[model samples]
Target: MTVSVRALRPGNRSDAEAFARIRMLALPYVFFTADSVEHLTARLHPDAHFTALLAEDDGEAIGTAQLSLAHESPEPGQALLNVHVRPDRTGRGAGTALVQAGEELLAGLGAHKVFSWVLDEPADRVFAERRGYRPGSTAQFLLLDLAKAELPPVPAPPPGVELRTAADFADDPRPLFELDAECTADEPGDVDHRLGDYGAWLEETWRHPLLRHDLTTVAVADGRPVAFTAVRTDGGVRYGTGMTGTARAHRGRGLAKLVKADSLHRARAAGFTEAHTGNDAGNEPMLAVNRWLGYRVCAREVQHVRELG
Candidate 1:
Protein backbone atom coordinates (compact mmCIF):
# COMPACT_ATOMS: atom_id res chain seq x y z
CA MET A 1 0.00 0.00 0.00
CA THR A 2 1.39 3.37 -1.05
CA VAL A 3 0.30 6.82 0.04
CA SER A 4 0.21 9.73 -2.41
CA VAL A 5 -0.40 13.42 -1.79
CA ARG A 6 -2.54 15.60 -4.07
CA ALA A 7 -4.56 18.79 -3.99
CA LEU A 8 -8.05 18.59 -2.60
CA ARG A 9 -11.01 18.87 -4.95
CA PRO A 10 -13.21 21.39 -3.23
CA GLY A 11 -16.16 20.70 -5.52
CA ASN A 12 -16.06 17.01 -4.66
CA ARG A 13 -18.41 16.24 -1.78
CA SER A 14 -16.63 13.05 -0.85
CA ASP A 15 -13.26 14.80 -0.72
CA ALA A 16 -14.60 17.64 1.40
CA GLU A 17 -16.34 15.25 3.79
CA ALA A 18 -13.24 13.08 4.08
CA PHE A 19 -11.05 16.11 4.79
CA ALA A 20 -13.44 17.38 7.44
CA ARG A 21 -13.68 13.92 9.01
CA ILE A 22 -9.92 13.49 9.23
CA ARG A 23 -9.47 16.98 10.73
CA MET A 24 -12.17 16.37 13.35
CA LEU A 25 -10.62 13.02 14.24
CA ALA A 26 -7.16 14.52 14.58
CA LEU A 27 -8.19 17.65 16.48
CA PRO A 28 -11.61 17.36 18.04
CA TYR A 29 -11.18 20.48 20.16
CA VAL A 30 -12.05 22.84 17.27
CA PHE A 31 -14.91 22.99 14.84
CA PHE A 32 -14.80 21.95 11.18
CA THR A 33 -17.74 21.40 8.86
CA ALA A 34 -18.24 20.55 5.21
CA ASP A 35 -19.73 23.97 4.54
CA SER A 36 -16.86 25.70 6.27
CA VAL A 37 -14.36 23.69 4.24
CA GLU A 38 -16.03 24.64 1.01
CA HIS A 39 -16.34 28.23 2.13
CA LEU A 40 -12.62 28.46 2.81
CA THR A 41 -11.77 26.95 -0.53
CA ALA A 42 -14.03 29.27 -2.43
CA ARG A 43 -13.21 32.46 -0.57
CA LEU A 44 -9.42 32.42 -0.26
CA HIS A 45 -7.68 35.48 -1.64
CA PRO A 46 -6.12 35.02 -5.06
CA ASP A 47 -2.83 36.54 -3.91
CA ALA A 48 -2.58 34.08 -1.00
CA HIS A 49 -2.03 31.10 -3.32
CA PHE A 50 -4.04 28.86 -1.03
CA THR A 51 -4.15 25.08 -1.53
CA ALA A 52 -5.73 22.30 0.46
CA LEU A 53 -3.87 19.02 0.11
CA LEU A 54 -4.96 15.49 0.87
CA ALA A 55 -3.00 12.33 1.43
CA GLU A 56 -4.65 9.25 0.06
CA ASP A 57 -3.94 5.53 0.37
CA ASP A 58 -5.84 3.08 -1.76
CA GLY A 59 -8.09 5.96 -2.81
CA GLU A 60 -8.97 6.68 0.83
CA ALA A 61 -8.06 10.09 2.20
CA ILE A 62 -6.05 9.61 5.40
CA GLY A 63 -4.63 13.08 5.95
CA THR A 64 -5.22 16.75 5.07
CA ALA A 65 -3.26 20.01 5.00
CA GLN A 66 -4.34 23.63 4.70
CA LEU A 67 -1.59 25.65 3.04
CA SER A 68 -1.72 29.39 2.38
CA LEU A 69 0.34 32.56 2.42
CA ALA A 70 -0.40 35.30 4.91
CA HIS A 71 -1.42 37.80 2.26
CA GLU A 72 -2.89 40.23 4.76
CA SER A 73 0.22 40.43 6.90
CA PRO A 74 2.43 43.49 6.69
CA GLU A 75 5.41 41.18 6.38
CA PRO A 76 5.81 39.26 3.16
CA GLY A 77 6.76 35.63 2.49
CA GLN A 78 4.94 34.25 5.54
CA ALA A 79 3.10 30.99 5.00
CA LEU A 80 1.21 28.38 7.00
CA LEU A 81 0.78 24.69 6.33
CA ASN A 82 -1.22 22.89 8.98
CA VAL A 83 -1.37 19.13 8.45
CA HIS A 84 -3.36 16.46 10.25
CA VAL A 85 -3.49 12.72 9.70
CA ARG A 86 -6.17 10.36 10.91
CA PRO A 87 -5.26 8.96 14.31
CA ASP A 88 -5.47 5.34 13.13
CA ARG A 89 -3.49 6.09 9.99
CA THR A 90 -0.42 7.81 11.48
CA GLY A 91 2.18 5.09 10.94
CA ARG A 92 1.38 4.92 7.23
CA GLY A 93 3.55 8.02 6.53
CA ALA A 94 0.56 10.11 5.55
CA GLY A 95 1.64 13.00 7.79
CA THR A 96 5.16 13.07 6.37
CA ALA A 97 3.91 12.98 2.80
CA LEU A 98 1.34 15.67 3.43
CA VAL A 99 3.81 18.05 5.11
CA GLN A 100 6.43 17.50 2.43
CA ALA A 101 3.94 18.27 -0.32
CA GLY A 102 2.57 21.29 1.52
CA GLU A 103 6.02 22.71 2.26
CA GLU A 104 7.20 22.24 -1.29
CA LEU A 105 4.12 24.00 -2.60
CA LEU A 106 4.51 26.94 -0.21
CA ALA A 107 8.20 27.20 -0.98
CA GLY A 108 7.46 27.21 -4.68
CA LEU A 109 5.15 30.15 -4.03
CA GLY A 110 8.07 32.13 -2.56
CA ALA A 111 7.38 31.69 1.14
CA HIS A 112 10.45 32.64 3.21
CA LYS A 113 9.13 31.23 6.45
CA VAL A 114 6.63 28.48 7.18
CA PHE A 115 4.65 27.73 10.31
CA SER A 116 2.39 24.97 11.57
CA TRP A 117 0.55 23.99 14.71
CA VAL A 118 1.48 20.73 16.39
CA LEU A 119 -0.52 19.18 19.17
CA ASP A 120 1.41 19.27 22.45
CA GLU A 121 2.33 15.60 22.39
CA PRO A 122 5.66 13.79 22.27
CA ALA A 123 5.08 12.18 18.90
CA ASP A 124 3.71 15.36 17.37
CA ARG A 125 6.58 17.47 18.66
CA VAL A 126 9.12 14.90 17.52
CA PHE A 127 7.65 14.85 14.04
CA ALA A 128 7.91 18.64 13.78
CA GLU A 129 11.45 18.69 15.14
CA ARG A 130 12.48 15.99 12.70
CA ARG A 131 11.26 18.20 9.88
CA GLY A 132 13.53 21.08 10.99
CA TYR A 133 10.74 22.99 12.71
CA ARG A 134 11.37 24.58 16.11
CA PRO A 135 8.84 25.30 18.79
CA GLY A 136 7.88 28.97 18.96
CA SER A 137 4.76 29.67 21.05
CA THR A 138 2.08 27.61 22.76
CA ALA A 139 -1.70 28.00 22.87
CA GLN A 140 -4.31 26.37 25.10
CA PHE A 141 -7.71 25.16 24.01
CA LEU A 142 -10.36 25.59 26.68
CA LEU A 143 -13.71 23.87 26.98
CA LEU A 144 -16.80 24.64 29.00
CA ASP A 145 -19.99 22.67 29.48
CA LEU A 146 -22.53 25.35 28.88
CA ALA A 147 -25.24 22.96 29.88
CA LYS A 148 -23.72 22.11 33.24
CA ALA A 149 -21.10 24.73 34.10
CA GLU A 150 -22.21 27.73 36.06
CA LEU A 151 -21.70 30.82 33.87
CA PRO A 152 -21.28 34.22 35.45
CA PRO A 153 -24.25 36.51 35.38
CA VAL A 154 -24.32 39.12 32.65
CA PRO A 155 -22.91 42.42 33.90
CA ALA A 156 -24.29 45.82 33.09
CA PRO A 157 -22.30 48.05 30.77
CA PRO A 158 -20.84 51.22 32.30
CA PRO A 159 -22.56 54.52 31.67
CA GLY A 160 -22.33 55.65 28.03
CA VAL A 161 -21.48 52.08 27.01
CA GLU A 162 -24.01 49.64 25.65
CA LEU A 163 -23.98 46.01 24.69
CA ARG A 164 -25.04 45.18 21.15
CA THR A 165 -25.13 42.14 18.92
CA ALA A 166 -23.09 41.87 15.74
CA ALA A 167 -26.41 41.49 13.98
CA ASP A 168 -27.17 45.12 14.74
CA PHE A 169 -24.39 46.21 12.41
CA ALA A 170 -25.54 44.17 9.42
CA ASP A 171 -26.29 47.27 7.37
CA ASP A 172 -22.75 48.54 7.83
CA PRO A 173 -19.96 46.44 9.29
CA ARG A 174 -17.04 48.75 8.55
CA PRO A 175 -16.91 49.89 12.18
CA LEU A 176 -16.64 46.29 13.30
CA PHE A 177 -13.95 45.79 10.69
CA GLU A 178 -11.98 48.73 12.03
CA LEU A 179 -12.31 47.49 15.58
CA ASP A 180 -11.24 44.03 14.43
CA ALA A 181 -8.16 45.44 12.79
CA GLU A 182 -7.17 47.30 15.93
CA CYS A 183 -7.68 44.31 18.20
CA THR A 184 -6.12 41.79 15.85
CA ALA A 185 -2.87 43.73 15.66
CA ASP A 186 -2.39 43.12 19.40
CA GLU A 187 -3.35 39.42 19.43
CA PRO A 188 -0.64 37.15 20.79
CA GLY A 189 0.65 35.06 17.90
CA ASP A 190 3.92 34.14 16.23
CA VAL A 191 2.84 35.74 12.97
CA ASP A 192 1.68 39.34 13.06
CA HIS A 193 -1.34 39.95 10.81
CA ARG A 194 -2.90 43.18 9.64
CA LEU A 195 -6.54 43.22 8.67
CA GLY A 196 -6.12 45.72 5.88
CA ASP A 197 -8.65 44.24 3.49
CA TYR A 198 -12.16 45.04 4.60
CA GLY A 199 -13.67 43.35 1.58
CA ALA A 200 -11.78 40.18 2.31
CA TRP A 201 -12.80 40.26 5.95
CA LEU A 202 -16.43 40.57 4.90
CA GLU A 203 -16.26 37.56 2.61
CA GLU A 204 -14.10 35.48 4.95
CA THR A 205 -15.33 36.36 8.42
CA TRP A 206 -18.65 38.19 8.44
CA ARG A 207 -20.27 35.69 6.11
CA HIS A 208 -18.54 32.58 7.35
CA PRO A 209 -20.74 29.50 7.74
CA LEU A 210 -20.10 29.09 11.45
CA LEU A 211 -20.03 32.74 12.63
CA ARG A 212 -23.24 33.51 14.48
CA HIS A 213 -23.86 37.24 14.36
CA ASP A 214 -26.91 37.04 16.61
CA LEU A 215 -24.89 35.35 19.31
CA THR A 216 -21.87 37.63 18.92
CA THR A 217 -21.83 40.36 21.55
CA VAL A 218 -20.17 43.73 21.14
CA ALA A 219 -19.68 46.74 23.40
CA VAL A 220 -20.48 50.03 21.77
CA ALA A 221 -19.19 53.31 23.14
CA ASP A 222 -20.75 56.43 21.72
CA GLY A 223 -21.91 54.33 18.72
CA ARG A 224 -18.43 52.94 18.06
CA PRO A 225 -17.53 49.33 18.68
CA VAL A 226 -14.79 49.17 21.32
CA ALA A 227 -14.86 45.53 22.32
CA PHE A 228 -16.46 42.37 20.98
CA THR A 229 -16.79 38.63 21.47
CA ALA A 230 -17.17 36.83 18.17
CA VAL A 231 -19.32 33.69 18.27
CA ARG A 232 -19.39 30.64 16.05
CA THR A 233 -21.94 27.86 16.33
CA ASP A 234 -22.52 24.53 14.62
CA GLY A 235 -26.29 24.90 14.82
CA GLY A 236 -26.09 21.98 17.20
CA VAL A 237 -24.90 21.79 20.77
CA ARG A 238 -21.37 23.13 20.27
CA TYR A 239 -20.31 26.78 20.22
CA GLY A 240 -16.93 28.47 19.92
CA THR A 241 -15.52 31.92 20.52
CA GLY A 242 -13.67 32.91 17.39
CA MET A 243 -12.22 36.07 18.97
CA THR A 244 -12.62 38.37 21.97
CA GLY A 245 -10.78 41.63 22.16
CA THR A 246 -10.98 45.23 23.37
CA ALA A 247 -9.60 48.36 21.82
CA ARG A 248 -6.38 49.78 23.26
CA ALA A 249 -8.20 52.57 24.97
CA HIS A 250 -10.87 50.21 26.25
CA ARG A 251 -8.59 47.79 28.06
CA GLY A 252 -8.76 47.56 31.88
CA ARG A 253 -12.40 48.60 31.77
CA GLY A 254 -13.81 45.07 32.12
CA LEU A 255 -15.48 45.52 28.74
CA ALA A 256 -13.90 42.33 27.46
CA LYS A 257 -15.42 40.37 30.29
CA LEU A 258 -18.76 42.03 29.81
CA VAL A 259 -18.94 41.24 26.11
CA LYS A 260 -17.77 37.66 26.58
CA ALA A 261 -20.29 37.03 29.30
CA ASP A 262 -23.04 38.43 27.15
CA SER A 263 -21.96 36.27 24.25
CA LEU A 264 -21.92 33.13 26.40
CA HIS A 265 -25.31 33.88 27.85
CA ARG A 266 -26.71 34.37 24.37
CA ALA A 267 -25.08 31.14 23.20
CA ARG A 268 -26.70 29.14 26.00
CA ALA A 269 -30.06 30.71 25.30
CA ALA A 270 -29.65 29.65 21.67
CA GLY A 271 -29.36 25.98 22.74
CA PHE A 272 -25.58 25.57 22.57
CA THR A 273 -24.41 23.07 25.21
CA GLU A 274 -20.63 23.15 24.84
CA ALA A 275 -18.38 26.18 24.46
CA HIS A 276 -14.81 26.06 23.12
CA THR A 277 -12.11 28.75 22.92
CA GLY A 278 -8.35 29.00 22.49
CA ASN A 279 -5.79 31.48 23.79
CA ASP A 280 -2.06 31.91 23.66
CA ALA A 281 -0.42 30.51 26.81
CA GLY A 282 1.04 33.92 27.57
CA ASN A 283 -2.23 35.81 27.24
CA GLU A 284 -2.95 35.91 30.92
CA PRO A 285 -5.74 38.47 30.67
CA MET A 286 -7.80 36.45 28.21
CA LEU A 287 -6.93 33.22 30.00
CA ALA A 288 -8.17 34.70 33.24
CA VAL A 289 -11.37 35.77 31.57
CA ASN A 290 -12.01 32.23 30.29
CA ARG A 291 -11.26 30.74 33.69
CA TRP A 292 -13.56 33.24 35.33
CA LEU A 293 -16.23 32.10 32.87
CA GLY A 294 -15.77 28.51 34.10
CA TYR A 295 -13.71 27.29 31.18
CA ARG A 296 -11.06 24.63 31.83
CA VAL A 297 -7.96 23.85 29.86
CA CYS A 298 -8.66 20.81 27.71
CA ALA A 299 -5.80 20.70 25.18
CA ARG A 300 -2.70 22.55 24.06
CA GLU A 301 -1.15 23.09 20.62
CA VAL A 302 2.34 24.43 20.06
CA GLN A 303 3.31 26.63 17.14
CA HIS A 304 6.31 25.38 15.19
CA VAL A 305 8.26 27.55 12.77
CA ARG A 306 10.73 26.60 10.01
CA GLU A 307 12.82 29.06 8.03
CA LEU A 308 13.57 28.42 4.37
CA GLY A 309 16.28 30.42 2.66
Candidate 2:
Protein backbone atom coordinates (compact mmCIF):
# COMPACT_ATOMS: atom_id res chain seq x y z
CA MET A 1 0.00 0.00 0.00
CA THR A 2 1.22 3.47 -0.89
CA VAL A 3 0.97 6.23 1.73
CA SER A 4 0.41 9.87 0.80
CA VAL A 5 -0.04 13.01 2.91
CA ARG A 6 -2.13 16.03 2.05
CA ALA A 7 -3.98 18.93 3.68
CA LEU A 8 -7.18 17.87 5.37
CA ARG A 9 -10.26 19.01 3.52
CA PRO A 10 -12.04 21.80 5.35
CA GLY A 11 -15.69 21.38 6.35
CA ASN A 12 -15.63 17.74 5.36
CA ARG A 13 -17.28 15.85 8.18
CA SER A 14 -15.88 12.48 7.15
CA ASP A 15 -12.33 13.78 6.96
CA ALA A 16 -12.63 15.58 10.27
CA GLU A 17 -14.05 12.53 12.00
CA ALA A 18 -11.38 10.32 10.49
CA PHE A 19 -8.67 12.67 11.73
CA ALA A 20 -10.22 12.73 15.20
CA ARG A 21 -10.50 8.97 15.30
CA ILE A 22 -6.87 8.53 14.34
CA ARG A 23 -5.76 10.93 17.04
CA MET A 24 -7.88 9.25 19.68
CA LEU A 25 -6.64 5.82 18.70
CA ALA A 26 -3.02 6.93 18.75
CA LEU A 27 -3.10 9.16 21.84
CA PRO A 28 -6.11 8.69 24.02
CA TYR A 29 -4.91 11.07 26.69
CA VAL A 30 -5.30 14.22 24.59
CA PHE A 31 -8.76 15.60 23.93
CA PHE A 32 -10.11 15.95 20.39
CA THR A 33 -13.36 15.88 18.50
CA ALA A 34 -14.26 16.21 14.84
CA ASP A 35 -15.62 19.68 15.46
CA SER A 36 -12.63 20.65 17.57
CA VAL A 37 -10.25 19.43 14.91
CA GLU A 38 -12.09 21.35 12.24
CA HIS A 39 -12.27 24.41 14.47
CA LEU A 40 -8.51 24.32 15.07
CA THR A 41 -7.74 23.85 11.40
CA ALA A 42 -9.92 26.83 10.61
CA ARG A 43 -9.25 29.19 13.54
CA LEU A 44 -5.55 28.76 14.38
CA HIS A 45 -3.59 32.00 14.05
CA PRO A 46 -2.73 32.68 10.43
CA ASP A 47 0.76 33.84 11.37
CA ALA A 48 1.42 30.37 12.73
CA HIS A 49 0.83 28.80 9.30
CA PHE A 50 -0.89 25.93 11.04
CA THR A 51 -2.18 23.07 8.93
CA ALA A 52 -3.82 19.78 9.70
CA LEU A 53 -2.51 17.01 7.47
CA LEU A 54 -3.92 13.56 6.89
CA ALA A 55 -1.95 10.57 5.71
CA GLU A 56 -3.82 8.04 3.65
CA ASP A 57 -2.77 4.56 2.61
CA ASP A 58 -4.57 3.28 -0.46
CA GLY A 59 -7.34 5.82 -0.01
CA GLU A 60 -7.91 5.18 3.70
CA ALA A 61 -6.98 7.80 6.30
CA ILE A 62 -4.37 6.21 8.56
CA GLY A 63 -2.50 9.03 10.29
CA THR A 64 -2.63 12.70 11.25
CA ALA A 65 -0.13 15.54 11.63
CA GLN A 66 -0.22 19.16 12.74
CA LEU A 67 2.54 21.37 11.31
CA SER A 68 2.99 24.98 12.17
CA LEU A 69 5.41 27.76 13.05
CA ALA A 70 5.64 28.47 16.75
CA HIS A 71 4.39 31.99 16.11
CA GLU A 72 4.04 32.91 19.76
CA SER A 73 7.64 32.03 20.63
CA PRO A 74 9.94 34.99 21.23
CA GLU A 75 12.60 33.08 19.28
CA PRO A 76 12.71 33.29 15.50
CA GLY A 77 11.81 30.40 13.22
CA GLN A 78 10.70 27.74 15.71
CA ALA A 79 8.34 25.18 14.27
CA LEU A 80 6.30 22.24 15.57
CA LEU A 81 5.27 19.03 13.81
CA ASN A 82 3.60 16.20 15.67
CA VAL A 83 2.66 13.07 13.79
CA HIS A 84 0.47 10.19 14.94
CA VAL A 85 -0.38 6.98 13.11
CA ARG A 86 -3.00 4.43 14.09
CA PRO A 87 -1.49 1.67 16.22
CA ASP A 88 -2.50 -0.87 13.62
CA ARG A 89 -1.12 1.25 10.79
CA THR A 90 2.51 1.57 11.90
CA GLY A 91 5.55 -0.04 10.21
CA ARG A 92 4.11 1.14 6.92
CA GLY A 93 5.00 4.39 5.19
CA ALA A 94 2.30 6.59 6.77
CA GLY A 95 4.49 8.08 9.48
CA THR A 96 7.36 8.71 7.12
CA ALA A 97 5.16 10.34 4.53
CA LEU A 98 3.59 12.62 7.13
CA VAL A 99 7.01 13.70 8.40
CA GLN A 100 8.35 14.38 4.95
CA ALA A 101 5.32 16.42 3.98
CA GLY A 102 5.28 18.31 7.29
CA GLU A 103 8.98 19.20 7.09
CA GLU A 104 8.54 20.52 3.60
CA LEU A 105 5.81 22.85 4.78
CA LEU A 106 7.87 24.07 7.76
CA ALA A 107 11.01 24.47 5.70
CA GLY A 108 9.15 26.61 3.15
CA LEU A 109 8.03 28.80 6.07
CA GLY A 110 11.69 29.46 7.04
CA ALA A 111 11.51 27.42 10.23
CA HIS A 112 14.97 27.02 11.76
CA LYS A 113 14.26 24.90 14.81
CA VAL A 114 11.67 22.11 14.60
CA PHE A 115 10.40 20.57 17.80
CA SER A 116 8.15 17.53 18.26
CA TRP A 117 6.68 15.84 21.29
CA VAL A 118 7.31 12.13 20.93
CA LEU A 119 5.76 9.65 23.31
CA ASP A 120 8.27 8.18 25.75
CA GLU A 121 8.16 4.80 24.13
CA PRO A 122 11.06 2.84 22.62
CA ALA A 123 9.85 2.72 19.05
CA ASP A 124 8.65 6.30 19.09
CA ARG A 125 11.94 7.64 20.52
CA VAL A 126 13.95 5.58 18.05
CA PHE A 127 11.92 6.86 15.12
CA ALA A 128 12.56 10.48 16.14
CA GLU A 129 16.25 9.83 16.79
CA ARG A 130 16.73 8.30 13.39
CA ARG A 131 15.21 11.44 11.91
CA GLY A 132 17.74 13.82 13.57
CA TYR A 133 15.72 14.85 16.62
CA ARG A 134 17.38 14.88 20.07
CA PRO A 135 15.57 14.47 23.35
CA GLY A 136 14.61 17.56 25.30
CA SER A 137 12.54 18.04 28.47
CA THR A 138 10.00 15.53 29.72
CA ALA A 139 6.37 16.07 30.69
CA GLN A 140 3.95 13.69 32.32
CA PHE A 141 0.30 13.05 31.41
CA LEU A 142 -1.88 12.33 34.42
CA LEU A 143 -5.27 10.70 34.80
CA LEU A 144 -7.86 10.79 37.56
CA ASP A 145 -10.71 8.33 37.46
CA LEU A 146 -13.24 10.71 38.87
CA ALA A 147 -15.70 7.93 39.61
CA LYS A 148 -13.20 6.05 41.77
CA ALA A 149 -10.68 8.66 42.90
CA GLU A 150 -11.20 10.51 46.14
CA LEU A 151 -10.68 14.15 45.17
CA PRO A 152 -9.69 16.74 47.69
CA PRO A 153 -12.61 18.74 49.03
CA VAL A 154 -12.96 22.16 47.48
CA PRO A 155 -11.47 24.63 49.94
CA ALA A 156 -13.35 27.67 51.09
CA PRO A 157 -11.97 30.90 49.72
CA PRO A 158 -10.23 33.13 52.25
CA PRO A 159 -11.18 36.70 53.04
CA GLY A 160 -11.82 38.77 49.95
CA VAL A 161 -11.95 35.60 47.85
CA GLU A 162 -14.74 33.78 46.08
CA LEU A 163 -15.20 31.01 43.55
CA ARG A 164 -16.72 31.43 40.11
CA THR A 165 -16.93 29.83 36.71
CA ALA A 166 -15.41 30.99 33.45
CA ALA A 167 -18.89 31.28 31.98
CA ASP A 168 -19.62 34.06 34.42
CA PHE A 169 -17.12 36.19 32.52
CA ALA A 170 -18.29 35.16 29.06
CA ASP A 171 -19.36 38.70 28.34
CA ASP A 172 -15.80 39.86 28.98
CA PRO A 173 -12.90 37.41 29.13
CA ARG A 174 -10.22 40.07 29.52
CA PRO A 175 -9.51 39.18 33.13
CA LEU A 176 -9.04 35.50 32.27
CA PHE A 177 -6.82 36.56 29.38
CA GLU A 178 -4.59 38.60 31.65
CA LEU A 179 -4.40 35.76 34.16
CA ASP A 180 -3.51 33.30 31.38
CA ALA A 181 -0.75 35.53 30.04
CA GLU A 182 0.88 35.94 33.44
CA CYS A 183 0.80 32.20 34.15
CA THR A 184 2.02 31.21 30.67
CA ALA A 185 5.02 33.50 31.03
CA ASP A 186 5.91 31.67 34.23
CA GLU A 187 5.21 28.13 32.94
CA PRO A 188 8.34 26.01 32.51
CA GLY A 189 8.82 25.15 28.87
CA ASP A 190 11.26 25.37 25.97
CA VAL A 191 9.22 27.79 23.87
CA ASP A 192 8.45 31.21 25.32
CA HIS A 193 4.70 31.11 24.65
CA ARG A 194 3.55 34.61 25.57
CA LEU A 195 -0.12 35.14 24.76
CA GLY A 196 0.46 38.75 23.71
CA ASP A 197 -2.05 38.90 20.86
CA TYR A 198 -5.49 39.26 22.36
CA GLY A 199 -7.16 38.82 19.01
CA ALA A 200 -5.32 35.61 18.33
CA TRP A 201 -6.11 34.35 21.81
CA LEU A 202 -9.77 35.13 21.25
CA GLU A 203 -9.89 33.23 18.00
CA GLU A 204 -7.78 30.30 19.10
CA THR A 205 -8.40 29.73 22.80
CA TRP A 206 -11.49 31.70 23.78
CA ARG A 207 -13.60 30.50 20.87
CA HIS A 208 -12.25 26.98 20.68
CA PRO A 209 -14.93 24.34 20.33
CA LEU A 210 -14.13 22.13 23.31
CA LEU A 211 -13.51 24.77 25.98
CA ARG A 212 -16.04 24.07 28.71
CA HIS A 213 -16.55 27.43 30.38
CA ASP A 214 -19.25 25.96 32.62
CA LEU A 215 -16.81 23.51 34.21
CA THR A 216 -13.89 25.93 34.34
CA THR A 217 -13.38 27.35 37.82
CA VAL A 218 -12.07 30.82 38.65
CA ALA A 219 -10.80 32.35 41.88
CA VAL A 220 -11.81 35.93 42.35
CA ALA A 221 -10.27 38.34 44.86
CA ASP A 222 -12.18 41.54 45.52
CA GLY A 223 -14.17 40.90 42.36
CA ARG A 224 -11.07 40.39 40.21
CA PRO A 225 -10.05 37.02 38.77
CA VAL A 226 -6.71 36.03 40.32
CA ALA A 227 -6.48 32.30 39.66
CA PHE A 228 -8.31 29.83 37.43
CA THR A 229 -8.46 26.37 35.91
CA ALA A 230 -9.82 26.31 32.40
CA VAL A 231 -11.29 23.01 31.31
CA ARG A 232 -11.99 21.35 27.97
CA THR A 233 -14.50 18.53 27.54
CA ASP A 234 -14.89 15.64 25.15
CA GLY A 235 -18.58 16.50 25.16
CA GLY A 236 -19.00 13.25 27.00
CA VAL A 237 -17.63 11.67 30.15
CA ARG A 238 -14.04 12.97 29.87
CA TYR A 239 -12.61 16.36 30.78
CA GLY A 240 -9.18 17.96 30.66
CA THR A 241 -7.72 21.16 32.00
CA GLY A 242 -6.61 23.47 29.26
CA MET A 243 -4.78 25.93 31.55
CA THR A 244 -4.54 26.47 35.31
CA GLY A 245 -2.61 29.16 37.14
CA THR A 246 -2.43 31.68 39.94
CA ALA A 247 -1.33 35.31 39.86
CA ARG A 248 2.03 35.80 41.57
CA ALA A 249 0.62 38.32 44.02
CA HIS A 250 -1.88 35.73 45.27
CA ARG A 251 0.26 32.59 45.18
CA GLY A 252 0.48 31.56 48.84
CA ARG A 253 -3.25 31.26 49.43
CA GLY A 254 -3.55 27.93 47.58
CA LEU A 255 -5.69 29.53 44.92
CA ALA A 256 -4.38 27.14 42.29
CA LYS A 257 -5.50 24.14 44.27
CA LEU A 258 -8.71 25.82 45.26
CA VAL A 259 -9.86 26.56 41.72
CA LYS A 260 -8.81 23.15 40.40
CA ALA A 261 -10.59 21.32 43.22
CA ASP A 262 -13.65 23.41 42.68
CA SER A 263 -13.53 22.65 38.98
CA LEU A 264 -13.06 18.92 39.59
CA HIS A 265 -15.87 18.79 42.11
CA ARG A 266 -18.13 20.55 39.68
CA ALA A 267 -17.11 18.23 36.86
CA ARG A 268 -17.74 15.16 39.00
CA ALA A 269 -21.10 16.42 40.07
CA ALA A 270 -21.97 17.14 36.49
CA GLY A 271 -21.26 13.45 35.57
CA PHE A 272 -17.80 13.67 34.02
CA THR A 273 -15.95 10.44 34.79
CA GLU A 274 -12.37 10.98 33.64
CA ALA A 275 -10.00 13.90 34.08
CA HIS A 276 -6.69 14.42 32.34
CA THR A 277 -3.87 16.94 32.74
CA GLY A 278 -0.18 17.36 32.00
CA ASN A 279 2.71 18.88 33.91
CA ASP A 280 6.33 19.54 33.14
CA ALA A 281 8.58 17.14 35.04
CA GLY A 282 10.08 20.03 36.94
CA ASN A 283 6.85 21.75 37.98
CA GLU A 284 6.54 20.56 41.56
CA PRO A 285 3.83 22.82 42.95
CA MET A 286 1.32 21.85 40.29
CA LEU A 287 2.39 18.22 40.54
CA ALA A 288 1.69 18.31 44.26
CA VAL A 289 -1.80 19.57 43.54
CA ASN A 290 -2.42 16.73 41.10
CA ARG A 291 -1.13 14.17 43.57
CA TRP A 292 -3.32 15.56 46.28
CA LEU A 293 -6.26 15.20 43.91
CA GLY A 294 -5.43 11.49 43.41
CA TYR A 295 -4.14 11.86 39.87
CA ARG A 296 -1.56 9.29 38.82
CA VAL A 297 0.97 9.49 36.04
CA CYS A 298 -0.36 7.64 33.02
CA ALA A 299 2.20 8.50 30.36
CA ARG A 300 5.14 10.76 29.53
CA GLU A 301 6.34 12.58 26.43
CA VAL A 302 9.81 13.81 25.57
CA GLN A 303 10.25 16.78 23.31
CA HIS A 304 12.62 16.25 20.40
CA VAL A 305 14.50 19.19 18.92
CA ARG A 306 16.22 19.38 15.54
CA GLU A 307 18.02 22.51 14.37
CA LEU A 308 17.83 23.19 10.69
CA GLY A 309 20.97 24.64 9.13
Report lDDT per candidate: 0.91, 0.92
**Local accuracy of candidate 1 as per-residue lDDT tens digits, 164-192:** 99999999999999999999999989999
- TM-score of the candidate numbered 2? 0.98
Q: RMSD in angstroms, all models?
A: 0.9, 0.8
The TM-score of predicted model 1 comes to 0.98
User: Lowest lDDT 10-mer window, candidate 2?
Assistant: 148-157
Lowest lDDT 10-residue stretch of candidate 1: 8-17
Candidate 2 lDDT tens digits, 50-132 = 99999999999999999899988889899999999999999988988898898988999999899999999999999999999
| Model 1 alpha-carbon drift over 4 Å, by segment | none
